[model samples]
Target: MKKQLFISIAAFGILLSTGCTKLNETVLDESSAGGLTDKQAAESMIVPVYATLPNLFTHTNYFALNEISTDEAILPYRGGTDWGDNGIYIAMHTHNYTSTDPNLRNTWNLIFQGISRSLTAITTLPGINDASAKTFLAEARAMRAYYSMLTLDMFGLIFVKEDPTALSEIKRGSEAYDYILNEFLAAEPDLSSDVTHGRMSKQAVWGLLARLYLNAAVYKNLYAGQFTFAGEDMDKVIEYCDKVINSGRYELSPEYFAIFNDNNDTNKEIVFAVDQRADLNGHNRMAYFSLSGDQFPLPEFVGANGTDGPAITPDYYRTWENAYAPEDPKVDPRFYKENLSIYSNANDTCVPAANFYINRGILRGQQYGLIRRNGVFLKCANGNMLVGKLFHDTRNRPTLPVDFTEKVDFSVEGSNYPSGYRVEKYEFSRKSASGRNFGEANIVIVRLADIYLMRAEAKLRKSGDAAGALADVNLVRASRTARTPAPPALSNMDLDLLFRERGFELYWEMLRRSDMIRFGKYEGTWTEKTDANPQKRIFPIPQTAIDAASNLPGYLVQNPGY
Candidate 1:
């Protein structure tokens, strides 16, 4: 396994200021000029490109921009004090963010860091004449394309940098769309056919192409009142999705939660993922981000607790409830998975098992966990664990129950630690039993189920083939046969139903914002957000980036309505 790459801030600043120039050889930890072979040098150049993914997808950065800004999640102040980072979370949920928002700025910098590192590899890897170097070059190009696509999606612009010493030509609108599409197309053929875990592969490129084409209409005209999904674009989406589906290399996991489990590195559903194997700079924040501080999943590590971050919005929860009305949504295998087997009763207490698992899916109502007293976990008379109803333990509200309410208030005073329903989609890392950063669960970027949904959406959009779309949606719903009474196949399919189905399968996965925009539902009011401005569809260019490029006037302009 490759060790995590560490680049210093000064070195990164030089690369950024120099317009994505080739890094100093010593920056890659070279002791001597001729110390490494061609293949080793090429590998070294590419590692940093992949290293940027974990930070880019950190819960507070890109994930926040994608989910919190949409109806899927919300992060509010706890007791009008905690998480009140100058109202940034509230501004993001309510669509009042500016270029100066810290989350936006961090996401912008992380995306460009990936882009810059890819450029360094693309420019420097060619020096190695070995055949293996060619494959690395293709992967570098694909990484650059992926970062560029994110740039277009978030900031409505792409930086086209070819010469390391020269200024980057900024592309926007159709120009940016074509550039990103061509980059992926150019790199697809040379990508390794064999699955390389964290690295980009041929199937990963197919998945990325399908995603790009599905959102082509939006990228072509970002600020449009309503995006016009073209038949050709939808055809491209179906074409690429068919390539992945027909390859016989991937499948839907029977246990829905297993797809996000700590041992999911080998799971067939994942196409492209940020490999967070042991020893890499993996973070467990995704697992504990939405969890209440009082609810500790791992008994061995009492110190490893939740930060009481974002929670699922009631509007999103209602979608699940309304879909399976009369029957509880939890009955659907994808909706919820109860993993705490030992603590079955409200007054249950037993020796905490080493393999304790937390409940997955939309968490609601009262929560139960190991009791902590006087900064120590309580134990039974037989030295077993004592499990009971939890209370607020971190935010100076110990008397308040840790019951997650469905409806969350937008105002600071109205919001509390347990205001909204929490989601535990990803499993907590056993390796990081003592901290939040040593997780080992791969952050899935593309997966087979999402491919099926993309194909289903394309089929519905292209010709309104309800049967074709229904078959695809049912395939995903029915594949989760591990739980009793799998999600029943729907007899009907439409745009509205397809949109809701996507949410059912792919919520809290950082796809909600783009999904809402593509389905023409972004401007609709949901929970605290009431802004209908189309210009808010894409975020503004970070003011810091704009100022850095001030020397070159008109080089980096902010998106409209900043």
Candidate 2:
């Protein structure tokens, strides 16, 4: 894993900085001095690949990919919210957004790195003689399928160079979908069915295929306008979903929060995740990115140095609570967790909760009646910590067992201050991490919860079998929550209901954008945003991509609305 990590990053740096002209025809770099003969050495390279998967799901990235893509969600317009203007640009192009930025290039590069590393493995893994070599390469191909799905989903193209020999002739555009599809189908047999969470298995491959075909209409279209799912594709979607279900390796975790509560990496629902391994002696993690205290957390989760980033919007929370069918009692338990601070910055005080929380607010606000021993609560007039969960980020850490709560405060005063809610889904770990770096986190990419929802969509579309879809959807809903009036009915019976259910179930998980697009809602209206154009469905091919292939003339024209 370590070798995989080093090679993936090193190769990525080389690919990003060097254009195609200076670099070899192919973008893979296997020159890593790491010996691949032994399992120990071979696994190092795999580590980087897995390690980097989490990078694409960070606040900075997910915001661009998820929330910004949906009208059901929005950026706070706060002074520092990133507001994800890049996604807004596409949203605006769709007529749902008006903001803009050039830095979305960063997102472009990060995903591309995933692509490059997968390519490197696909091209190089076959040369090894180890008994497990084929298994590893199959994993590599699965990664390629994963990223290629992203590329096809986002850019409508593939790099098309699995083999070093096919390097020079590689092309991009909607034309690349065929190759991407073939790659995934080819690799499915090699994946295992052992039911590993966050590890690509045969079931996961099926999920990818399900997702791809579900959106086949959009990918294969000549002009993207109100794209609709085709019958054949929808059938395939159902086929694959059933394959995943019949495998019997995974089932929805009874508790949504438990899936990510701590050590969620083992959850049966998780098909893939970022292995946030922290270096105890080196850099403190999960704490650095999500922690608030500057005194502990490797002394990095404080002051201007910390990310102190994005929070759940009040509007989004409302959607979760209101989107349910009222007749069904079980909704997502995570919904209640949506906008609260699950970790104390450093002072150990509970984080705040409110429509727009800033800091040190209440754990449950006035909504649930839960609170701290001090009778601390949300101030409605001030919107301070009125709707939140204040736990301790430093409750665990390997380095010093240091109390991150002692070093900071979790309260806020104004502006975009949580809008009264902090996302507790990725809580600060009590122990820093594997190596005590405080950077460790349990990643939840394709959890069982997600598969349930994906299958619901497929089944619903396949036969207007919202009854079947409703069952699957409600299964997830029933697992996570308890509610007043017996919760809501599983309305997978209605397309609109099913669509909204997805947004409510998958909020902030990086799947929202694609889900919205699949449901034909990407260009829909949000609280304060809207997509204006059709071409914006897919992102503008990064400007750098054009320059790299500019010599080929018409080789890489940008997607419209650039």
Candidate 3:
């Protein structure tokens, strides 16, 4: 029998009682309603908390806020038509978004849903009075802290709710930072050290702590003109990073692309990720979001298509291009992975192949894929597949070739079907043949490379140990030995170079915005964005959230510069 954990409507009422708008109240999974053992009930309670992650991290919501708003990506109005979405993408890219923006509202709601669900588990799990239930409670608290940290990063405030009925006490500045840090520290003892896949574990806690400490200055003074990286905080960051590094539970993946592949759930490098396996509700938007509509990756499902979403900005592309000078960034194992092995020539009439995989990493120039005639895929006389050059799929100019150009303009003509280079870091899901939604690739939130980078940054910032920092950065750079002509290590490292190295290693993973702010480049002009206002560092609280809490006179105040 399928295990079903049915959370009652009253439990949902508790979430809604807080007056937060758009709280997802649906049941987690559909299973035959029946009595469950205490062990089963505890497990069921924690499942919904984990389920909230997929929705929170979806490309349109959290991803848009983090990537599109920074120089790493741009989502312009394609050919003056599609993806306009009431100009939210443009507003986000330009930092002109207001409190009423749907993306902000949606992201805010989704995060709170995670917080609320975790809170529900934290409050109810103790009733079981079992050893497993205690562990589940610890996991719930840790998840709540994670959601709270995200809230602090985005909205400049953290919500603290003891129970469901009363309003949440808001914390900001040091209070917020301390609360999040303490929550994790408190839960660490009870969190299982064993790898639990999607669930919170000890190593995940350590990674999260390292991340929190690495950015301690930013959290401590969010709107300050300049942040002061305290030595003590840096020490803590190093301490936590060392814990994960020496744990022997993880090692860097030689093939960098395999870290984000479809079967990456068991990958040792992934410390924490939003689990999106075959049986769960995983979306392939991360894989197909930036792809051209004309490109079809899956041979089995011709209907599976890309939505032509945001692409890597020229400003970000230059970081890789100019990094090694003369030597093309393509040589770097992390930069690109060639997967279309059967067909090398774009003009090939037919190639014998049972499987087809598209090239990964930063894609440029003309794209090649299986061609279709009328409603059927074209095949050779020998029953092999035909590969051909791709053009725009009628949504844009059909005659225009799908050649990605680096120089993207803000104008309609400049933002054509193929302007900025598209990223294919995450592997396309084979399970979702009909559409680009059900992806099995677990969206990585924390990994070993990031841990190493965090430690390096802390080492440099805390003590100006340039040599020590360089060694750590090169460790990550040299770990990708799977690719031919492995990425060369840097002879020297500085703050600017270290920042660029982070981009080269971790771009499109949704860490760019925070990175830019912490590195003092958030105010720097890039491409079309020129506003250098400090207030733009944190997003305005959603107007809907403010309106929902209107009953409480000063409970939910909006962030400045709305």
Scored by CA lDDT, what does every candidate get?
A: 0.82, 0.52, 0.83
Candidates sorted on lDDT, descending: 3, 1, 2
Q: lDDT per residue, candidate 3, 1-562, as tens digits? A: 1221245423443332221111122223334123656665666567667767887888999999999999999998887777989999989999998999999999999899899889878878877645678888998999999999999998999999887887789999999999999999999999888844577889999999999988889998988888999999999999999999999999999999999898898898999988777656566478889998888877776777777788888889998888867988888989998877534554555655556778899999888787755656777778887777788854645678989899775786668888889998888888754546777888889999999999999999999999999999999988999877778878998999999999999999999999999999988888789999989999999999999999989888888887
Question: Candidate 1: how many backbone clashes?
Answer: 1
The estimated TM-scores of all candidates read 0.93, 0.72, 0.94
Per residue, candidate 2 scores C-alpha lDDT tens digits across 1-562 of 5455456546554433221111111222335334434543334334444434555655555445555455533333332342434444334223432213343556667777876666676655565455555666777787777877777777666666646555434444445666667877887777667634545678778877877787777778724666766778878877887887777777676656556543565566666565543321112233333323211212112221223333443445556546554622123354543332333232323322322222221112322212222323334354433323333222222122112211111122222222333334444444443322333455566666666777777777667786888888777777654222223455436777877677666665667667767667665554444444556666666667676777788656666566
List, residue by residue over 154-196, the lDDT tens digit for candidate 1.
Answer: 8888989888777789898899999999999999889887854
TM-score of 1: 0.93
**Among these predicted structures, which one has the highest TM-score?**
3
Best by lDDT: 3
Q: Which 10-residue span in candidate 1 carries the lowest summed lDDT?
A: 17-26
RMSD of each: 4.4, 9.8, 4.2
- Model 2 worst lDDT run, 10 consecutive residues: 18-27
Candidate 1 clashing pairs, residues 3+ apart or interchain: 350-385
- Give the distance in Å from residue 526's predicted Cα in candidate 3 to where it truly belongs: 1.0
